[model samples]
Target: MSIPLVIFLFAWFVFLVIFTFLALVSVVQMLRFGVAGPGTYLSTVTFLAVTGLVLGGVGLYLAGVDWNATLDIALTPLL
Candidate 1:
């Protein structure tokens, strides 16, 4: 893999880890505070965590594929 691709993938991985950690912290806080107020904060944080995990998994999967082919397929509709 090229240096740039490697860097990009590494950065993506790092961000995923960071966001996951943040989500976990939010969950812990919500639990400690109990289901007070409207509970929207807990729900929103949970959704963000789930979305981050899904996107991170997809990013890792794509990292193993040929970038040219992936981009071509992804951008085909726009061309």
Candidate 2:
């Protein structure tokens, strides 16, 4: 089977969109309902920091990839 390498990039973009929506919802829920304390603020800050670091790292890694290509896979059947 063969598929365009760009398919993975499109999939990643979809995942990123969903992740961003969920992250926004989580922060809103946390702030709207959680007790007012340093713990709540700290947790939100930590979550945002980790999310930024991970996304930044992935961006750097993806910058070098050549998206104009295709991937081919071979499958063998055993019966």
Candidate 3:
């Protein structure tokens, strides 16, 4: 793979992992701790962080990262 492709893949994967982890943490805290054991704060922080990350990823992808063209795979017409 090209260097730019590798870099884009790495960055996109990192963003996905972070977003998934934060979302899971938020769900677990809400279901397990509610507002107790500092879970409330943690959940809030994770949710906000994930939101920011997703927004940033979208912006980066839209700014002409050619590797991001793969994202259309998710929206492509399936046979």
Candidate 4:
């Protein structure tokens, strides 16, 4: 692979790993502490955690080779 592709893949992988880990941690924390904690703030935390996970997944799908057939082919020669 070309250097830019390699770099993009590496950066995306790292970003996904770190973001997923953080989202998971937040979800766990929300589950654990939410019930005993404040009502309004707990809901906000849950919302943020779920949103983070969903956005992270979308980013992964976009960055990974999942959509390669259409876009990848066009970009392959450039790479």
Candidate 5:
């Protein structure tokens, strides 16, 4: 609800959308071009995109729950 939290959530949402979009694009390109085209590069991109999307989704869900508490819990271990 605070300005910084809202901004953080917005950025996180944007990243999730972008990651999901990239993943879909990567899969489509891989299928259309096969292994001979972009080859392993596409595969790598697809993997990273999938990982990012999953993690981002979890982050967004946590943010929706209680952003402050979630952030505190998440950062606690790091500190």
Candidate 6:
């Protein structure tokens, strides 16, 4: 029932990779196939900015964490 805290970091990394792929594909589709308009660029910029802020916050939060820690999870039987 012991889990390493670094596992969370690993999970985040996986999520980041997936998010990056999806975002790239979305932006490509918008710019390549969608209509030409200001809203397209605006949406792209907003999406990137929001993503940056979110990842930056996550980085700042993780900065102070000690990855060497372990979490003990206990499960009780439910009858």
lDDT of each: 0.69, 0.93, 0.69, 0.67, 0.69, 0.89
Task: Candidate 1: list runs displaced more than 4 Å.
Answer: 36-53, 56-64, 67-79
Candidate 2 lDDT, tens digit per residue, 1-79? 8787889999999999999999999999999999999999999999999999999999998898888877776553556
RMSD of candidate 4 to the true fold? 6.6
Q: How many backbone clashes does candidate 4 have?
A: 0
Tens-digit lDDT track for model 3 on 1-79?
2244556668877987997798777677676767576667776777778778877887787667566343434555778
**In angstroms, how far off is 23's CA in candidate 3?**
3.2
Pairwise TM-score winner, candidates 3 and 6 = 6
Q: Residue 65 of candidate 4: its Cα lDDT?
A: 60
Flag regions of model 6 displaced more than 4 Å: 75-79
Local error of candidate 6 at residue 1 (angstroms): 2.3
Task: Compose the digit string of candidate 1's lDDT tens values, residues 1-79.
Answer: 2243455666877997898799778777776776665576768667778787888889798868764432233434653
lDDT of 5 by residue, 1-79 (tens): 2244555778977987997798779767767667665666767677878797878888687756754533433344553
Per-residue CA lDDT of model 6 for 1-79, tens digit only, reads 9789899789989988998999999989989987788898899899989989988998898999999998776653557
> Model 4, stretches more than 4 Å misplaced?
36-79
Cα miss at 28, model 5 (Å)?
0.5
Q: Which candidate is the best by TM-score?
A: 2
| Candidate 6 clashes between residue pairs 3 or more apart in a chain or in different chains | none
Measured against the true structure, the TM-scores of the candidates, in listed sequence, are 0.51, 0.85, 0.37, 0.45, 0.46, 0.85
Pairs that collide in candidate 1 are: none
Task: Predict model 6's lDDT versus the native.
Answer: 0.89
What is the C-alpha local distance difference test score of candidate 3?
0.69
- The positional error of residue 61 in candidate 6, measured at the CA in angstroms, is 0.8
